[model samples]
Target: MYNKSHAQMPMDRSPPFSSSSSDSSQFSSTSSSPAKSMRVVLSIECLKGSSKADEWTGDMLQTGDIVEELRIGNMIVKSPFKNGKSGIQKILHGSFKQKETSIRVRVRRGCADLAELQACIVPGDQFVGRKQYVLRAIDDPNYAVGFIDRTESQCLDLQASRTSRMVSALERTPLQDGYVSYPWERRLVEMLSIPNSSSFYSVLFLPKSSDKASARYNDLEDTLARAHTWINASQASGVPIVFMNIQTESLLTKISGDTASSTVNAGSLSDLSNIANTSLYGFEDYHGVDLGVVRAVRLWFSPLAGEIPIEIRIKDTDTRLGFAISRTPEGFIYISSVIEGADDVPSARSGLSSLYKQASQSARLLVVSRISNQKLLPWMVSATGAIRCFDTVSLSQKLSLHRHTRVPILVHVYLWDRSANNANVGSIRARAMSTSPPTPPSTEAHLKMTARGVEEGEEDSDEEETVASDGQEDITIERDTAGEFSFRLHDFALKNNWV
Candidate 1:
């Protein structure tokens, strides 16, 4: 169990432990009794994937030890150190305690701008408070063992909970789907959520330390209101939602002052000793939670990963072809690498490489722009009610409810070539619209002919429809009229010729 006196505990003892509260602002705290028979066995692993991993064994760790992050081995290495002055760390053996190196200082090392820093802390802080130290399932889709930070932040203490109101509210929060609200107590969740090649790091909430309190109850409530609205909207659509405090992953962008080094070079021995310091910008104390939740939802539904194209097939309500999908900011849900694959698929099989050759081998993926008789990319927002993105629920529901010999799923695909510098950056496909049937004209030349036909007294018998464009992919003109045209993708190359 954690205590106010936990700071007074010594290292070299043992861990009954667990642990990010954002902010250099004082972390919030409240203690409870941990379970007698714990399900989560927690420990801290330092310098994972680096030489330091060997040095900082999980068993030797204790609470309050000063730890710094070193970028090494394409990872964030958490190694133990002493503050410039002495610090507190506790170590509790399985059934005993051991003496640890603890020293008290007389003259405090003070900050230069104490007044400015003091203004950062807020009193009566209820909403955006302290960090969460334990994670478990209300119910989970993936195996719980995979996401737990078992090696490092593995177990709950005698009792540990979120110190802030916002943090606690989210802990163990349930979705209609029966999963916990958030499981990101550590980087392990990030690794599982994203591709294996990606690395995870915790963002410091309230990155700045302030002795002075500055939170207004009204403003904090307003922020919560916005987050709540989004959560309700997303839940109605069957996507699990959460309150994200620290943002750990983002699109890797290159900035002038902080150029990311080569993964191999950054992990070198020389670089290991000289770790990069987190800049002030890296320590942003964001006031609102809406943007973070929005990005998280966007990621939850995204399919593309590191520019590689992935394919997904909706087989049933609970069954899928592969990979967790996400919507691009452009509104199209592009496929990413496979996160999961069904053991039994009824689709026509072809070697992936052979399918690639259909597009001259430049294409690495096929994006599903349409499903059955419905479009994934919307042509128009329903003025009557809420906006829909990729009739996602409708697609799954169709598979679950409908009967078919083989589930005639028509998936429209576009080639995603990864060799280009601008990956998923902008609009990559072109379109020409038509309201008539027969062969659904494919060019401006055909559009001209259709217009000319109407002018020349030709009878346009087939019902007319509209397919809007994102200036990228084509629209569906045959969903209702032709009973979902068989989406046989004979061509996979992009019109851009990157193919």
Candidate 2:
């Protein structure tokens, strides 16, 4: 994945370079040439529609570079490839093929036509899904833009043209409070969304929430063009736009959840972060593809719900407690993991492990509800009908309390078993829950395997033999990949046949 943060080009006049590649040199000699000629013909994950890498012809000539000609359909576009960019290319150049001429690319600012387009989409302008823009004509408002999607052709080419006229465009779209796609912009998303019959197309970045969806469609000059008057991205609002050229294979894997097809070696959701890079991934189908089947992204990566507050008396700080804490986006704070060696700590010896049985083995993350007298955010029910939220800034002061200085602190952890049972009995309404008092924390040192609180139709896994145990044969458990769990567990059980 050729990763580079993209920035939208500023509004300006005159296209970055002349339309003709003929003016470019077959050899590099910019010092004597006047035209700064180049064209980036690579697929941008966010800009191109096809979930595959694409290439096109470029006029940027350089010395000692191998430029292969790609014959796609009737188009003989030069494949814009560079040797130094790929390790395999280096190997080939040094040993096998012996082609010293390696390609070098200078990625210009994103959006080559920022100056002429003048970044202006007035009210009532619509985008059709296929890169077509239907807006007021620059020359005459009555005569709408017949066609604006053609790149190899003129800016105003039509199936029927009254006259050959050049329409001057705005320099910039002017970044405003309203959402706007940078680098590829909204236009490029549509362009990519348009079907590619000749070759595959790739985008620069992962599309924002509604990147594939267009509000409107137009069929001017008999060409399909997607048009959206409004900007896309409800989840990306206020988030800075970062232009990145991720691998096309990566986007497909995350979008389709197909690990076998992924080229970036993305085994987990964290690995695909460079693509969507947002926290709004619902543990469901990405786009329309169910993640359960493809098994591309790890679902249980971030499980924090709210601020979790834990209080413990100062024990010896040198013992190196195995317990670790993590956060979730939902606002639930919980004990993420408890190291096995934590039993050596003074507090664990006294009874902390008793309070955290399965938690020690990473069986489950224990949710913390309160610390001593103070209740953690949202978890506490108050008569004022208010849910206290955690302020990391102020709360960190208490969490950072010196172990050697502080006395024993009462830690109130939410027992998952009790929570499940309570929910099973009947879920408490927010109104009633707001007035409830904290439940007495359970302090059992060795909870049973049944204490895991498995839901109906799901049995306890601990009853089955561990993979390391004797008389255990590993079996595959078919499961939904998009579910809370990303991978299927290898069930090790006693081999028995009773039909």
Candidate 3:
């Protein structure tokens, strides 16, 4: 009869078995008696110094450890195979060729306790499971018996694989489980994965779609087309575009503990009353819980319009800047008025008059997108859907300091495009108004501004005054003795109501 007690004996007493040099000899010795169990187990000869060994095995495997079973994913190859060591080698080679990420080996170490070994054994099955046994090499001093921990690299690989599978499933069926989805193309994904590529992109989520004829649906199509065009054009100019989507609920959960479920109950009645109101609080709610969507697409691309970057140097003799600044309701800071015929001022020297003239002739606004290399454009959107921008008061102070210090300022302006016919500006303003909440009177008073420096009581009565065209408003700042304007641009804007 097979001696079960002998098989369970401590491995330290037995002579070292070298499977690499004499697999056949070891198998023959074990198979000598027909009544005895012939288990052809493999042992670790030595581990290679490769990174794969450290990442996949580390100290879990050691020299002279008995490998009872090998597992690759769901497939398990146990000891006592048909061809002994050669069979296990063939299986391992096949797994390597298949590029399997997970490879687990159930090993029995010399110091493993007899009680622990017996406890690890399966009740019904003869073969031991991969996670059942713990190696003494791993839990030496502590002697705690549990499943081996996965390496960091291995954990990351598993997570990446899971995410990939989930994304693939999402791409297959976008609309699933009351969630709208948009999958990024593989090319866009690759582009975005490149280092520092995130800053080049921006995302905007649209409301949920129920009707194809609805304006929301049309807007979505238009936005997609525009983004596509921008990306294509940017790519042509050697700039790669990044387009991506993320789950709104997941984002909200991470940022704030609020889930889509709570908002869903709040908006349920309203959603039932008006099918058009797909969101819990309409489109103005940027939190995105009301959209009932898993993913929304956002695109980032290089500048599409011909943005002219102008460098204006403040000379010692210059007093008046020769231009007025104002912002549109859509958060565009623009040259509202220019002191005509001023030759020595910084604005005229920088050729702002010519650009202003072109803009006037084309019925377009001379918009300043950036000042002193810092972007002055609307940089963020509030939860209430208001366009959040750089405070003009602070910007005026910065400009005033620059003038006092005679520091040069760089500005980026969007030149008037005859082909576009101011359509871009008009569309942006219309879109902002459609989704944005009405600006409170107090807030409007604080933000709106038109600023120009003029001599005391130098009113031009003959200059047919129009608000959009160099018209004198309620607030006027007199030029100081040094010729620098001393009033805050936002203060002027508040009094004039020039938003």
- TM-score, each model? 0.18, 0.21, 0.36
Candidate 1 lDDT tens digits, 1-499 = 2122332333333232322122322211211223422223223221112122211122222222223221212322233322311111111111113221111111000111000000001111132122211111112111011111221122222112223423443464454355567655565546553323231111111112112331111122232333344333332322211222322222222222222221113234553322232211111123311111101111112222222222333344323232222333222443322221333432213122333334323322234444542335422211121223443223433433332223444444443334433223333201000111133344343222221110111123331212122343432212221123312111121121100
* Local accuracy of candidate 3 as per-residue lDDT tens digits, 1-499: 1122323333434333221211223323333344442233455432122222221222333333455555566786665455655565456555555765244444543223111121111111122233232222222222112222332233223323433533554476333266666655665556552322232325343333345432222223443554454333322222211223222221221212332212333434665344222232222255553443322335432233446778888888765566656655444567766666668878889998788777655545677766755666544332223444554444655676677688888877765445533234456432322322232233223224323322222233442223332333455443222113222232342222211
> How does each model score on lDDT?
0.25, 0.27, 0.42
Q: What's each prediction's clash count?
A: 33, 47, 2
RMSD of 2: 27.4
Model 1 spans > 4 angstroms off: 1-326, 336-344, 347-366, 381-388, 401-405, 419-499
Residue 76 local lDDT, model 1: 28
Query: Which should have the higher lDDT, number 1 or number 3?
Result: 3
Off by over 4 Å in 3: 1-250, 254-304, 420-499
TM-score winner, 1 or 2: 2
